[model samples]
Each structure stands twice: as C-alpha cells, then as structure tokens.
Target: MLPTLAQTTALIRHRRSIKPQDLNPARGVERELVVELIENATWAPNHGVTEPWRFHVFQDEARHELVREMERAYREVTPAAEFREDKLQKIGTNPLLAPVVIACVMERHGGAKIPSIEETEALACALQNLMLSATAAGLGSYWSSPPLLDGATFRAFLNLGPEDRCAGLIYIGWPREGLNWPRSARAPVAEKIVWRAAAGA
Candidate 1:
C-alpha cells in the first residue's frame, strides 16, 4: 500500500539525523529491521532503472573490522605532525557507538543514456528513502561522511572496483537515553523558489 499524501509529507518533515553520539549503544537495532530498511531503499527512483545504489552493512564482529581498518588507513594517510590522536581515536571507536554501520557505495554505471552525476543522484535518492524508512520504524539514524572513508585502505576493505566510489558510512541505533531529537531551522520556501512562468517576467 502506498502512503497517503499527508503521511508522505509527515515522513519528509519528521526525518532528522540522529548522530551516533546521540544513540544508545546497548539497545541495538535488530538485523531483520535493518534488512527491511535496506529493502525500502531500493524503492527510490532510478532513471533508466539503473539502480546504482549498493549497501555494505557492518554489524556485530564485522563492525569491529570496519573500525580497525578505517583507523589504520587514517594513520597511514595522515602526517604524524598533523595527526591528532583524538581524531584517530574516533576513527578507531565511533562504530562501537552505533549498533550498525552501512557503507554507502556508488557504482557509476556509464553508458549512452545517463551521466555519472545522474547515477549519483539516484543513489542520493535511495539514501533518503533509507533514512525515511528508518525514521518511520522509530529508529534513530544518521549519514556520516568522515575523511577516513576516502582513504584507500577503507575502499579496499569495501572491495569496491575502480569505477565504484563510496558515499559514506551511515550509523543506526536506538536513540540515546535522555537526549532529544535534533531540530533545525530552514529558510522559507518563498526565499528559495523562483516562479518565472513567462520569459523575463
């Protein structure tokens, strides 16, 4: 069944990033629920039906591997003088804060029909679908594009091909105790929309 217009708008408005720091480490989201969330992601619009989105879910023991490899890559790439141990610590430990981690990879499908940008846009839409699904499930989630994600070692861990580039890792877990969901202010739609029905009107 499709969501009603009001329900759809409610989801768009209610979706917000719940940072890993604001998530409960003990109360993890179940694997079954995560699988359902990813399935929902596939429903996002894809031009020419390329379906360019690929997700690598990190959970349980594998989450530890993800953090270790990422930290190692960070240390290898960063100059010793510029390397902050605190930041390295985050690379080493942040995944432990979340119940699950999803490595968002984009395999650019190049052909006569669509450009790389369009493929990436399709992947972005898929991610939005994922977040909306997570929110509707009452699960707190956030997409994070950390610098460690760009390092070669991290890519190697993901086993992505030369044409594939990762978007980032998304963290998912239950909302942290005693923390409120974040709220942000946006400019009025009138300020951004330019209605030009006629030429130079």
Candidate 2:
C-alpha cells in the first residue's frame, strides 16, 4: 500500500534501518511493487540519459543461488588461518534475512561527456529515489556497501568487471512491530548553506 504525499514525506523522514531479524517474516513485498519502485527510481535527473544504473534482484528460490555464490566467493578470499567458521555461517545467512536483495551496479557508458564521478553521483540520486519509494510503499530498506566493497567474494559472485563499480546493496523487507526509528537530527540549514555577495554590492 502506498502512502499519501504528506505521509510519504513523514515516512522518508522517519525511515531507519531495521536489523534483519526485526523484519517481518510473512510480509514479503510483491514483485509488482518492487518493479514499480524501480520504475519510479528512473525518474531521477540524469545528465545525458546515460542511464548507467543496473539492478539485479535476488528473491524467493533464486536467493539460494546468490547465497551459494556469496559463500564461494568468501571462501576464495578468506585465508585458511584467518577464516572463522562463524564468519562463513554469517555470510551464508546474510541474504536470506531480507525478502529482496538488490545489487545496485553502476555501468560505464562509452563516450560519456561527463566524468565517471558524475555518473556515480547521478546513480546515487536514483538510489535515494528508490529508498524513498520503498518507504512510501510501507517497506523498510537498508542501503549497504560493506559486503559489496570489502568482500572480494562478493565481487566475484557478481562478476563485476574492470569498469563496473558497486554503488550499494539494497535490502528491502517489511518491518516488524516497533522496528522503525526516529530520524537523526541534522545541522542547522543556515550553517550548511551559504550566500556569497560581492562585498554587499
């Protein structure tokens, strides 16, 4: 179910990360709703329609394959002596915690007029759109990059190329009761924004 405009704003402002265990077990989001959220995400501003965003969604039975690949990658990277049995167990368990795991990949377009950094920033905006849309849809989402960035195992699992970079991993699921937290306070807008006039001219 979608929220009203004011409710949507409130949802976005209050949305917080719920631990995997705190996600509702029986309330997986429908596939159509996921598609809708992604469609809305595309409305974000893009510099040249390069549209470098790519999403690989892992869900239902397909999540098993993703988990298997993640474990394989983890083993490849973990040194024999340093590897902890529990760490491997956690890796195997991570993806199943969410109803949907979205791989947010930034693809490089040939002959891009702007720098690669600009392309990545544009993708970030798209991700924000996705997060907000999920909130409005009564779902909880967490944007994570630790596993995608530091885990060489994760890189191999995704088959990332030289030019391809991971922007984040999005985990979406229904929130358990009392799982939502209040928003963190921000610095004053006056302190963050500045107006420059030429010596009061």
The per-model lDDT (C-alpha) reads 0.85, 0.76
lDDT of 2: 0.76
The clash count of every prediction, one per candidate, is 0, 1
Taking the tens digit of each residue's C-alpha lDDT, what string does model 2 give over 1-201? Answer: 866889767766776765556667567889999998888777877778888778889988777887787677667766789777897787677678888888887776635577778778878988889888887777888887644244666665667776767787788888877764536777887998878889959
Off by over 4 Å in 2: 1-9, 77-87, 110-112, 147-153, 180-183
Model 1 C-alpha lDDT per residue in residues 75-159, reported as the tens digit of each score = 8778878899899888777798898999998876757678878877888888998999999998888998877667789788888
How many Å off is the CA of 64 in candidate 1?
Answer: 0.7
Kindly report which residue pairs in candidate 2 clash with one another: 73-153
